[model samples]
Target: MATLNFKHLRYFWMVAKTGSIARAAEQLHLTPQSISGQLTEFSATLDVELFRRAGRNLELTEAGRRILSYAEEIFTIGDELLEVLRDQKVKKTLPFRVGIADNVSKLIAYRLVEPALKLGEQVRLVCREGRLASLLAELSIHRLDMIIADRQMPANLNVRGYSHLLGESGLSVFGTSGLAKELSGSFPALLDNAPFLLPGEDVAIRPKLIEWLETSNLRPRIVGEFDDSALMKAFGQAGAGLFVAPTAIVDHVCEQYKVSVIGRIDAVVEHLYAITTERRLTHPAIVAISKAAREDIFGVGKD
Candidate 1:
């Protein structure tokens, strides 16, 4: 056996993470040739093939996957050591990487994650926003500590993860004061032909919302659709159209967007979940978030 080189291991880890030599090189500020050479040397030292070519892309072999797992632990410890030394603290700040589904409400995402920061542990939170599928792919590779989503992990998804239901709330419709006053007929009746801003079709709530509209026999004109909940509220505040948000933060939405609640859709419930690879939520930050959301935010016990 040959002596292992940390530099070579780091290069290999970067390649595995980005899944492309060019991308890894860009992230490391090195040339692709340099990274390739390091990987070659690292594989030679291990006496096993690390990567297999698949149509211009690199895929890790079985041996490579096993080595990469150990490499992850090694680099993670190295990061913690550096942080402890730099901060001169007995306990290093823990890094918590959470992926937020693009369609999830920004305000709700904030409320879900806020408890993690107050868990009395020094936590460094890194949030990435993207589509649920893309985030799930990253989570499968152990890149994300957890995912905050409006819906639970699909049972058909190939990834091994458990969805912990954070809480659920009814939907509330909101609009500018002028718009609210202009469409004054009744609760469900006022929504007939009303200008509305709806969530994009990609959101989990879209189907439920559509069903609710049909059930109530309301046919509001959808003037705009938004993937981002914050942007939808912004347009609604500008009187573009009425929008719906979870009732969990109804007060915050109304005050922040300067909009008045038109009505609540109790039938269209919005569920929130914390999806993780671990079946048991043991991370300090994860535990805090789960407890706070169930007890304080969602009021699960009071019911």
Candidate 2:
């Protein structure tokens, strides 16, 4: 029997986590050819076929699944051992890595995560903004400490992650002062035939907002659709159209975007979630974010 190759095992682990050799190679800072060769060598050493193609993705064979389970344990323990060692270093800066899902409001994200910087310790805050599925991939590979998302982990996703509800916020409609002034009649009635800027179809709030509009029987002409909530707010600031934003950070939005709230829609709520690999949050930054979101931002934790 030959001695085990820890490097090969690590490569396999990364590929399994990312579900692509190219992605794993990118993370490892190695060439795809190099990793491909190494993977071949690793499989030959073990004398087993580890992967088979399933559509565009690489599916682990039964043997590969067994190997991956062992690899996960090995690498996870190795990472913890390194973390324990790193913690002993005095005044060492802790890396606080977070991913913000694209659908989440930037204003709310900033407020929820800002408390981590004031933890009175040396902490480096790094944030990556992307789609929820992409952020979940990063979370599964341990590249991100946690994900700040508008939704929870999808049940169909194979990644093992837990979602902690930060809190929910009802929505508010905002428009420029001139636009708000021009609107006639009362509340929902005023919104009919009004110009509107809506979140993109891919966004979690888009469907809910549509349903609310349908239920209320108000159909504002959608002047524009934006994937970036911040960008949508910018258009709203310019009097392009009225837009909806979470009421939790409505004050910040109104101030920053220089818009006036036309009305509040308590029926449509945006549920915020913190998605992480661990069920019980252990990271100080994550803990701080969850606490601040519930108590300060969403006003749920307070008595």
Candidate 3:
């Protein structure tokens, strides 16, 4: 196979960014034919088609999107290098990329990651939110430095990673003022036959919640289900139904969404984990996050 060509890669990146060979040619001060030939050679070298024609426009293929992500990082680093060499006082900012599971409470996620930004070192924090499986895939490829999730990495997954328990928080149910008034009963009894919003089955808490409801013999009317915790809270805030959040962030959730707490369920606990490629946490940002979560946020040591 031919070695990678930075020149061809640069041309391909420009074409991808401009969405047209002609536009890229104009920007690079080159002929359209020259840009087209470079892209063709680049694609052939990579053994993948980067773009597909869509009407009069070009759309990136899956392979193209993946390559574009790398290209963006490459060009960003190149620009930073130039700045550092050109200016003696300039300091390079360390990039800390974290993947957050969608089902994790947004407030809890923010609190867990907030400490990393406060660290003395200048850092560029990039947070990507998605499903656990998808985020784990990104982490496996070294695209993400760490992943924050409700559950630990599954044993069945082939990815090699260590799960560090951040801390656990009991569940707290909340509802709009009207709903709270309407369902005025003591504790779990108030939840019986009450309209409820809940996390989808894909969320780690869903199964535990279901089991708890069944054990309590409380059959709440299921009004809505959500894969995203934020969306579930939004619906709950609008008086759609009652929803549960981690007690660790109950105050913030209530303040932000203007919801009232219906009750707390200590039995239905939520556990948070930080999954990283390293068995022992060593990264400065990661260490700061772990320390803050245990000492401040959750107020408990690792499990």
Task: Please write out the lDDT profile of model 1 over residues 103-149, one tens digit for every residue.
Answer: 99898889889988887778879898999998998899998999999
Q: Write the per-residue lDDT of candidate 3 for residues 198-254, one digit (tens) a residue.
A: 799878889999999999999999999998999999999999999999988888999
**TM-score versus the correct structure, for each prediction:** 0.77, 0.72, 0.96
* Best TM-score among the predictions, by candidate number: 3
Residue 251 lDDT in model 1? 90
lDDT of 2 by residue, 106-178 (tens): 9989998899998978787879899898889878888789998888899999999999999999999999999
Spell out the clash pairs found in candidate 1: none
Which of the numbered candidates is closest to the native, going by highest lDDT? 3
Candidate order by lDDT, highest to lowest? 3, 1, 2
Q: Give the TM-score (vs. native) of candidate 2.
A: 0.72
* Residue 117, model 3, lDDT: 89
The clash number for model 2 is 0
Model 2 Cα displacement at 153 (Å)? 0.5
Backbone clashes (count) for model 3:
0
